[model samples]
Target: SVPGPASKSIITGAINFPFPTLRLTLAQENLSQFHDLDDWGFQQELEENYGRVVKLTGFSGYIDRHLFVFDPVALHHILVKDQDVYEEMPKFLCLDLLVFGEESSLPWGTIIANIAKTMMPAFSTLNLRGVVPLFYEVAERLDFNSISCRTSLELIGRTGIGYSFDPMLPGQEQTDRYARALRGLFVTAFKLQLFIPLLPILMNYCPRRCMAQEGGKLDGSEEGKDIMSLLVKGNATADAGMHLADDELVACLSMILFAATDTTSSSMNRMIHLLALNPEVQHKLREEVLTAPEHLDYDKIDALPYLDGFVREILRLYPPVPVMFREAMSDITLPLSTPIIGSDGTIMHTIAVPKGTSIYVGLAAANHDKSIWGEDALEFKPDRWTKGKADSVETKLPGIYGNTMTFLGGGRSCIGFKFAQLEMKVVVCVLLRSFSFSKPDSGIRWRKTGIMPSPYVNDEPKLPIVVERLRA
Candidate 1:
């Protein structure tokens, strides 16, 4: 059996106590610590005390034991080599169905894969280059107070679906019903986390309530330049078997909007925050952007070495979605890069995971693993990418981008990663070129809200940065 902290209650397992109770067990403390937003210390402790792979007791003593895995070889197997076996949990799919819509007869994975394939050209370098000016247009008018959410929504709206959520004018408020609902979805989802099992029952009462209101009208006909338009066009031409149903198309609209907005915005906000903290690094990056040609197309922006390194380092260190969950569909033997001793003191190379076993893919932990990324893994050093140090890092971990699990890996990996990268770089370049950012008076705390964490100041979702315009 895998080694793990003992559970206090066999029925509750390692479930965290809501009320403060005296004489808590180690298992309770471990589980409680797991919920912390800044989990770096907890991750390190897990690695030290329990190795890269720790068995966590959840809900039930033995039946509900979950594996918290950050082991490189195990991660590769779970994320890439044998991803099909470690599929999304049913409850999660139920949550998706609740948010998106009814799943078609086709497997959810197949649907996502098809949609991702159809949308590839839309996010291609040549295509995204045309939208650089739009990104800058939004970035230039950004207010640091609510910059991430509103700006990201407007950018995605204009470039992603040929819509405009906000006009970016000073003192203007977003009045679009769809945009309001879309922005609220994350908070709604976060509140509904505990009720995931009841999502199926709730679907019967409020079937696609959120998406059905506005998403159905987004038929990809507006201007015909956005990704939604391309998807609709592609689906029109695809063979009968490959054709997406009406609901599926609608789901895609909401999915793209919801997924793209929060993650991209969170990352952008974090980048700005990091820049404010390290003025020297920010100045250096700004210099790189400034020294480049006045007009920066996709190629020119991408060619900036320091800018690329800065983006890469931020994504590596602070992946918007820090963790992802999966469940085993069948009995499988999971491989590990290093052998670990079992609870019985036996050195084990491979572990047998039965069907229905829960698995937690520790993305942030893997990115910060000192063994793979060297001793200074915890430091925010963008130069590692430019200094030949990145090459020394282990390559066994499977990630879609920058040798980190920020975007995950395998068929279900983030399809719009390229689009996101382009969006982030373009916005960063535009913002840095026009303005200088400094830390605010109050400390910023990144709280895990929904799928992505957001910056909070004094318990409110705001990043109050001191911004000074450098040029008119």
Candidate 2:
């Protein structure tokens, strides 16, 4: 007998076109066993019952066949080996275009690669050191629960484009036109559920909530000698086809602001929450940070073993973006590390994914796969790093950092991953040195929307932590 459900099962060996489709009505016996609600839950359930790879069918009437992959070998194959065969889904890109315009995302792959290559040096550790004091200044006024969003804004402002947006600075009010517009834009765009295909048309008709036109003339304080300014200045000197249009420049600025703020903040919120829940770990981390050299530089921070492990563990356990969506550009066979019994009673070494199939790369699931990480896979143990954690896993998971699927891998990996890591390390070091964090109460919980996951209390996006100031 095959591994899948028996009622609508087909035999193996004779390759079928669409493979066996799991009906949603019978989802309880099939898909529901894995996950019916959220991405994290789905990945956990899938790995528990179906092992590495599972074929899902009948997804909200659009998709016919979708593959939920949790195996590290399969992830490596999909993300690294045959990446060209798969690309970002249209929905994600459409949302990007609606929000940031054609310049930043319309031709996402090539443009992003080019932009990242061009701007990589600006965000590198060497050039970013000058902003350390700015972080210290920001950390002095940090509100543990709400600091993530504001601190991230300041970091990106001072470093990314040489501007300052933190309310503490003179003429840098949070209610400033640009800041106000950006905040209003997020609230409005999210309200529209911008991922829907009709958003472009809807936004076009609804001028009040349209983010694409919200900037309204990027003159005065909004324009500066920052990254966007350089891009605009450089574009002015370049040939027509070689440069960005005015709208494109505005979108680039918006994209930078939108992408950096929430993700870094969300991560900060979660990491501190983890530290608070485990008081022993928090004390150990604080001691490490405080005992480090009086002047902590990029190299010194990077050298902290425990801190590195702690951050990596946080990303592994609770990646802000849990699942990555991809569409098969062509029919292809995905190589699997472990073979699975097909629904037809045949031993299958590879998965035959047809063209146009939606594939959800299970990031969190692969991070916690028992086969890769051993029995205590789901537990958050920072010590896992010291004990040959990477070596213990026979199969290599394709990711930019810590041999985990946190930052993803391949051509479309997170371009700002290094910047994000540095920003996080600096903030954690500063905050831990001055204060301690712990859970506010027993009722706090983490939840995920369609996009990213964040913490909540009483059904509101709030992370109230117990904080204590450390004295010299």
- List candidate 1 segments past 4 Å from native: 8-11, 16-27, 37-40, 143-145, 194-223, 387-389
Best by lDDT: 1
- Residues 263-354 of candidate 1 have per-residue lDDT tens digits of 88889889989999999999999899888876688788888888888888999999988889899999999998999999999999999999
> Model 1 scores what on Cα lDDT?
0.77
Each model's lDDT comes to: 0.77, 0.65
> Model 1 Cα displacement at 176 (Å)?
1.6
| Collision count for each candidate, in order | 0, 5
Model 2 stretches astray by more than 4 angstroms: 1-40, 59-63, 103-107, 143-145, 168-251, 386-391
| Residue 31 local lDDT, model 2 | 40
Model 2 global lDDT (CA atoms, 0 to 1):
0.65
lDDT (Cα, tens digit) per residue for candidate 2, span 1-472: 2143322322221121221252333334334433322334555666788767877643332345667787777788788777767777875666666555532333466665555554454455655565566556665566344557667777776665556676555434365455445433443554455444555433332223222322322444454434444444555566655665545455556556767777777788888888889999988888898889755876777789888888877888788777888888899888878888887778888887789987879898888888888888888887777532553766678887777888888766776777677778888887887887767655676666435666667767677888888887
